[model samples]
Target: MKAIFLVPKDYKLTGGMYMPINHYVDYFNRNGMIVDEIIELPYHKDNTCKGISERLHSKLSEEKYNIVGFTLNICYMMLRDFQLHKNSNCDCTCFLVDSMSLNMDSVIRNESIGKEYIEHILKFFLYELKEKYCLRNCNKIVYVSSVDKQYVLKRFNRDILGDVFVVPNGIDLPNEVSDKLVRNENDIPTLGTLTGFSQETLNNNLYPFLYSIFPQIIKEFPDIRFVIAGRGASVEVEEKLSHLDNVDYIGEVEDLHDFYDKVDIVVTTVKKDCGLINRVLEAWAYRRLNIGFSKNFAAFEYAENGVHYLSADNEGEFVSAVEYAIKYPDKARIIRDNGYDLVKNKYSWGKSGEVFLDIIENK
Candidate 1:
């Protein structure tokens, strides 16, 4: 079998949509399907719609491929173009990283009304049209999580023409779990989290925790420290962090191993329920005790509340969870071990690849 992947021009090997797409390409090549080409479409550049359509059509028509895969996050226009100039015998599959409708809805509701908000509203309707087109035209739709799959189905009224499959995101596990330092009774405990620090993330995930939850946690464990690492900190974000005495705001971490090693507990502050939290998986892979809201963990159905990791919903619960982890280090270690085992056994690129390959071959 021969295949070709259509990806955004700005796609990288590690972040964003590239993670799953890279795994899928590797899996297909190893399993007798030759990935002959990975065509990078100039979606981000200022090209006319007709120009992009022509370029996509020309590239796709250059070779005869059994399968053509698309990363549907930002390439909705390409999908529409592909449908218009598709080969009758070739099959098409779309890989959705998350529900664009849900994400856009959240952004519009959260962001204040302004020029940016108007732009989002326009993009939201545009995405709606493209999403429906892809759903009605493609041969198969692949989702990173079941939560996203269900949301897309309900939003589109289950009017999809293609078969939908849930292929959860996987992690690249560390070679060995890092050794955590033994805490003396007088030593201060540390809590850590990482984010891109976008305006949306700051408002929805980090700022809420910093303002409402962290104060209560600080009241109980005054000696506890919070370590935050990620890029894109605006002046306002910097000012906000400066006011908090307990916060150690490291600008950006070059390697996550060091971040995981320094913290006693990993907290995922993402409030969105649409996609799988990579931090949760990373914490488990590094054998660190993770505390996150139950809703954030909803995408991974296999992860249990008390067995795998701690779950806290609101400020009071979150503060209490942090307090418990700090007080009873031994019990926290058990949860860390359990989470490590779950990730080791259930989450991997190979597993996700196998499922994707099965769907492609069987179809």
Candidate 2:
């Protein structure tokens, strides 16, 4: 079967949306399906609509695909384009990687500083409305995590939501990278976190929270230094975080396993998400104990609360979890073993391939 996957834009080696494309393309291609990931859509840096509609419409004519899927982002043009194809009786499946609703919050974030700049996005509600209407009309909608599924379900009834499917993102066991987890007597314990600076967190709302939380974590375990790995830092975020004692900003890593290898613990501090995150799965593959907020269900699904991962509902709880993690070394070991077992048994990419094929065939 020929399957075409639509992403918000092309893969940039960094960003939250790239994970599903990377994971899915490998799985589908290996199983005798043509998986085409369309990454040409523009973003803030390149804000040109520039014939994207014609390009996607032309792609459909090039080949007869049995299924077409979408990877949702802050923008819904990718989602709407897929619906246009599906409406033409072109068999399709959509992966709403984020919430089902229009991204008003993201629209606000992508807004520019100038008077006419932000005004354009602010006045484009009808375009967002069109996207929302198209999503409601699509044949099948796949969610990256159960949290996403529930949020969409709660907001819009099944009557409005068509064939809704919830399949959490899967992880490969990382057999090849297993040998690379070499521990060195490094300068610090290497507590690490990854994600581009999403505009949501780039604001001043989160830095004070980090300041309050990190200092307490250090007092409990002085040997550990934090690595904020990713390309999301703005001039403000960089200035605030870079000079701080041991917080290292390793911008846009080529191989994430290298970052994971040096870390004693992986942290996911995402404040919101309905989908499963790729960060937790990477940690699970390396047998690193994950500690982070409970709101991110992707991590919550793989790393059981207090079992395969440590969870914190609040700032105080996060500090306490870290303290307990350092004091009890066995805790990390046990969680690591359990995390790998869970990934191997339930969340492998091979399993994803088999299930996805079934979805296309059955639909």
Candidate 3:
């Protein structure tokens, strides 16, 4: 079988989206399928729908591929292009890596943003409509997490549920988990997060909450330190966090494992219901105890509320969880061990490859 995968134009191979999609391509090829990846679609960053429409129609009209897969970002054009190739013998699948509906709902719920926010709602509504159409029409709908799959089922008609499938994101495990549970003979605990600095990241209200909650944590455990690392941190964000003595910002990092190795605990403060946060897997791989909201762990199968990692939903709970980890060293070590075992057995790239092969084969 021959297949083609469509990714958004200017899609950087850097973020969480790259690894999962790359795994899909490799899995298909290993199963005797010839897969061609096309990242030349002209819609995402460019709003010229008509030109993109014409080009996609022309491309699909020329040949019949056995399977045409679309990365979720370009779902708006998937169905329209597939319509042109309807005469050809091919199957269509959509891999929804992110939730457009949830994201739009997030923006719409905050009515204080004014007129432009309404425009964003209408625009996102069109994208949601297109996504629903593709989900209804496609041969298979692959979701990155079961949480998102359930979210779609609740929002859309019940009939499409059967077509939906879950193929969780995979990670490359580190060779060895850090054994340095204590901070250099001082025993001062350090917690950090490596996150992108964007409006979406800010919208989660995570960093700001941490900024507020950190002072509280340090009041009891005075030696604790919090490190924030990522790109796009505006001056405003930096100023807000600058007053705290225990807080530090390292900006963007080239070696994430080195960052992971240095920290005693990994903190994920995502406030939204979305795909599996990649940080959770990385934390487990590094044998670091992760403390964050339960929603961030919704994308994985092995994470139990108290088993794999410490769970916190709100600001108060998060502070308490960290305090508990700092006060009770034995419990923290247990969490780290459990998380390492879970990631080792179930979350590797090879295991994800087997899952994808079964998905494409209709198993």
Q: Each prediction's Cα lDDT score?
A: 0.76, 0.62, 0.71
Q: Which candidate gets the maximum TM-score versus the true structure?
A: 1
For model 2 the local lDDT of residue 275 reads 56
Arranged by lDDT with the best first, the candidates are 1, 3, 2
- Candidate 3 global Cα RMSD: 3.1
Q: Compute the lDDT for candidate 2.
A: 0.62
**Across residues 221-272, which tens digit of lDDT does each residue of candidate 3 receive?**
7878888788788899788768758878877788876687668888887765
Error of 2 at 338 (Å): 1.2
- Which residue runs does candidate 2 get wrong by more than 4 Å? 12-19, 29-32, 35-64, 72-89, 100-131, 158-161, 175-189, 204-209, 232-239, 298-303
Candidate 2, position 304, lDDT: 62
- Models 1 onward score TM values of 0.89, 0.76, 0.87
Off by over 4 Å in 1: 44-63, 66-70, 73-75, 107-122, 181-188
For 1-363, candidate 1 gives per-residue lDDT tens digits of 577677777677447577777887888999998887786766543555567556555655665455444555444654554454266546677776677766677678767888888998998897777778778777688777888788888888666986888888889988876757234433456888988877778878888888888888888878888988887898888888988969988877888876887787888877665778888888888888888888778888888887888899888898887767766767777888888889888899899888888877786
Give the least accurate 10-residue stretch of model 1, judged by summed lDDT: 179-188
